[model samples]
Target chain A: MTKPVLHLQPRVKTMISNATLEQASYEIMKKAAIDIPEDYLAGIKSVAAKESEQLSGFVIKTMINNYEAATEDRRPMCADTGLPRYYVKVGDHARFDGGFTGMERAMRSATARATIDVPLRPNRVHPLWRTDNNNNVGINSPEVEWSFEPDADWIDITTVHKGGLFGTDYRMLFPGDGIDGIKRFLLDTLISFGKRGLCCQPAIIGIGLGGSKDTCMQLGKQAACLRVVGNRNPDPKIAELEVELKDVANGIGMGPMGFVGSSMAVDLHIEVGHTHTGGMPISVHTFCLSSRRATARIHADDTIEYRTDPMWFTPYYRRETVIWENT
Target chain B: MLNKVNLDLPASPDDIAKLAIGSIVFLNGIVYTAREGVYNKVLVDGRELPDDLTSRSNVNFHCSPAASKNENGEFHIGGVTATASFRFSKYLAQWLDLTNTKIVIGKGGMPVNDYKNILAPRGAVYLTTVGYGTGALLGRGVQSVDAVHWLNELGIAQALWIFKVKNFGPFLVDSDLQGNSLFAQQGELINQNVEGLYDGLKEPALHRYGETGNRKDELM
Candidate 1:
């Protein structure tokens, strides 16, 4: 859980190398694919403990075994391997040997290398042509999104391998529609994709409220992939709604693989942004059974620390208000 | 405890009859991978399949293994999981008729209509992979990559792969001889309480075009 400092002296001589970044990137890719995060593992265990349906319970127990098998075998938990993508956070004071573009090249090559070494299913392709590059790298295939952190001197990179289909949607609602509208949309997305376990239930459901449509989609996806189970929004009301939504999702009378049970959600996360007063655009994203994600923080000294928890939504990243709105 | 059975590949009519919805299944023998890519090639393009294909194996897997060729030209398969079966429903009937495929394995089960109308009469059954994330376990069951086809054209994800497998399951029987489907039965039970989840949620002020009250086309 690294936090941003208010002010810090910038260091001069130490710079992280591009090779180190690539190595870390490739390592996290493997880790994300094979090892289910500790928090999510605990969350699923709790969900399994309370799952009452006989068959659904069997599925959960099988999943527990699957996770162990994945680690011991050192193989990916799921063959889909998903749409591998990245979130790169650059510390303002950080210095690296290669420029940003060079880092990008390193990341891209790392993606290609990991795809073959780990043999990740090359899931990406041309939108219409369907041409497979076979390396999981093509024209903007493994999307790399960048952000910056203030008063920090380390670059943090998180890779998320999320499924491309199902358990996601976007809708435009009027402010007049209110929270009830949100509830309806959530139920609609869940029930629709939760059929035959298409969305792969007991998933971590993420909701994005406010912002424009595109931002809403990004926020919701980030809320789903970037946050760990049981982590809540900073806003108290949003946090409470998170709890309520999880209960609602779990009470849907469905469990893993869409079987009849009460374990539909591992947890629910909500992210919001100020938007046009006239409309509330919303997006829902469900990070499924194999919620694969991993993070690495590269210090100025080039020492890297890898972990499952992303710690992506730092307080500074979610700060509200502007001291000066106009010049 | 759910009933579990080990099925032999190139199964006979009697073997398919023993399957029932909700039972777990494992397979021993040969299975071949074929989805839209292989389907369009053989069924649509009117191409000929291997002469002894049906005689060799009757199980058509809607799968694409995470596999790669090592420097030695041998394949290293990491994980194996099925793609959604419902999407390939259009090809199954023809595929089954052409190749005598008796067992279909994939991620989600095929449509309920598919079971009753297409599969039952042909003595075919559907088995859905459990968790849909049991790739590693399934990978362990793969004895060897016996052969592969269309690797260059369809690519690995859509290539036709022939695998020798043992203890290859943990798949739930989604459809049986009588056309009864485990998913459909469970779905019906789930739908009974589905409305309760939206008991008090009101409609939004704005509704998108083509937004139906129900997803009638949803697979069972």
Candidate 2:
């Protein structure tokens, strides 16, 4: 596990080149568009093996073939390349040549280049006028979200091309509504979008419980896109809930394309934040069958290493107790 | 076993009638891509059909291809996937009657009633792209770009694409001539057992006015 930009001095740090960052960004975009992640591929295959319905089975088998075809031909796996976006983690100790604005420009430039090079669908458009630059780059399009990590010297750029429409919802429930309320809303979302395969199950279902409405949505989206199958919440009780919810979802008697079977979800993940004492706000996000995501680790040495896992959630990131040493 | 069949493009009336609700199909010959953008243009805007659209293809796909043009103006097609079909239901009747389209291919099929009322009545059947994610496999079948319209007006996602394809599908016949639909049938079967999922699950303290508790009825 070679960390890009590892072992930097506390006082003297190397500044990463903006061009190198853009280059890494572009490569990740192509990799995410063309290659199905190994974690997701394995997860879907397991679900497909358990799928009993003939039609549902056929859909999974064909998707496997589609993955192969996409790789062989070096094309976007799905026609709807989805809304390309970035989740970047910056190291507190690391330095970069470009200012924040310059970094943003590099990302935008990379998005346009990948849109043409990978021939991405250019799906982003203005909400009012329906205007397109034909490069998938527009105002507030290809959103870049930033987070920070302490005591690290590498910038991890993760590109997630999540489908824009369907399979996501938010609800506000009272504390009295409890886990049962969570389960009910989860069922509503899954069954609602799962019908006719609109959500494109078997998917990675991410649930965000407890947070401000916007934060709730963000946590759920990150949970679905960043985490891999078989990963669980750090808290044992929450992990248990994840497992129970996964069972409840699959027991809905639906599979791929909403056919009768046992494979509605490959896995379900949950992320939480402290919320209003009176409200339990929750959001659900489904990362579809294609599950397009790839990451690049840009080290201080200007070397870029690509990987499938995002590793966005760290112990410090999810610090249950504040990490401050002094009271 | 699931029934499988191959149908030539500009399908004849006989071929349309023989398709069963759940049978898988592979298409040969020409197919044209149209979605809300093209639908609004032709049906709502009262624009004339592009020259020879029907003569070139009878199958109308609700799709946006992963396509772009290089400096040389040669189009590069990466993949093609269908969008959900239900959103386009309002225009299907006018579009079908106007063009004599015999096949409508998209992601999820239109609402069950739309199939019986609008499509079957107009001699049109809906074919759903299998998995909805098989863009690459389908892209492989596109042999040539015969023509494209509205590239300047409607962006690539909404442009009218005339693709000459071969063995170009593994689509499931969603609606037959009898107005039967594969999705509705499958939904009913799943709904029968899914009702148990809500057992002992409590509803939220407050409900949205538009919310429906009937799980059997889908949100679509």
lDDT (Cα, tens digit) per residue for candidate 1, span B105-180: 9988988899999999899999999988888889989999888888998999999999999999899999998899
Q: TM-score of model 1 relative to the true fold?
A: 0.95
- Residue-level error in angstroms, candidate 2, position B160: 0.4
Candidate 1 regions exceeding 4 Å error are A1-13, A324-327, B210-220
Could you tell me how far off, in angstroms, the CA of residue B164 lies in candidate 1 after the best superposition? 0.8
Candidate 2: residue A286 lDDT (0-100): 92
Please tell me what DockQ candidate 2 reaches. 0.80
Q: Give lDDT tens digits, candidate 2, residues A92-120.
A: 87678887778889999999999999989
Clashing pairs in model 1?
Answer: none
Tens digit of per-residue lDDT, candidate 1, span A12-91: 54889999999999999999999999999999999999998998999988888888989999999989899998999999
TM-score (chain A only) for the predictions, listed in order:
0.94, 0.94
What TM-score goes with each of the models? 0.95, 0.95
Instruction: Give the Cα lDDT of each candidate.
Output: 0.89, 0.91
| Per-prediction DockQ | 0.77, 0.80
Q: Write the per-residue lDDT of candidate 2 for residues B104-191, one digit (tens) a residue.
A: 9999898989988998888889999988899899999999899999999999999999999999989999999889988898889987
In terms of DockQ, the best-performing candidate is: 2
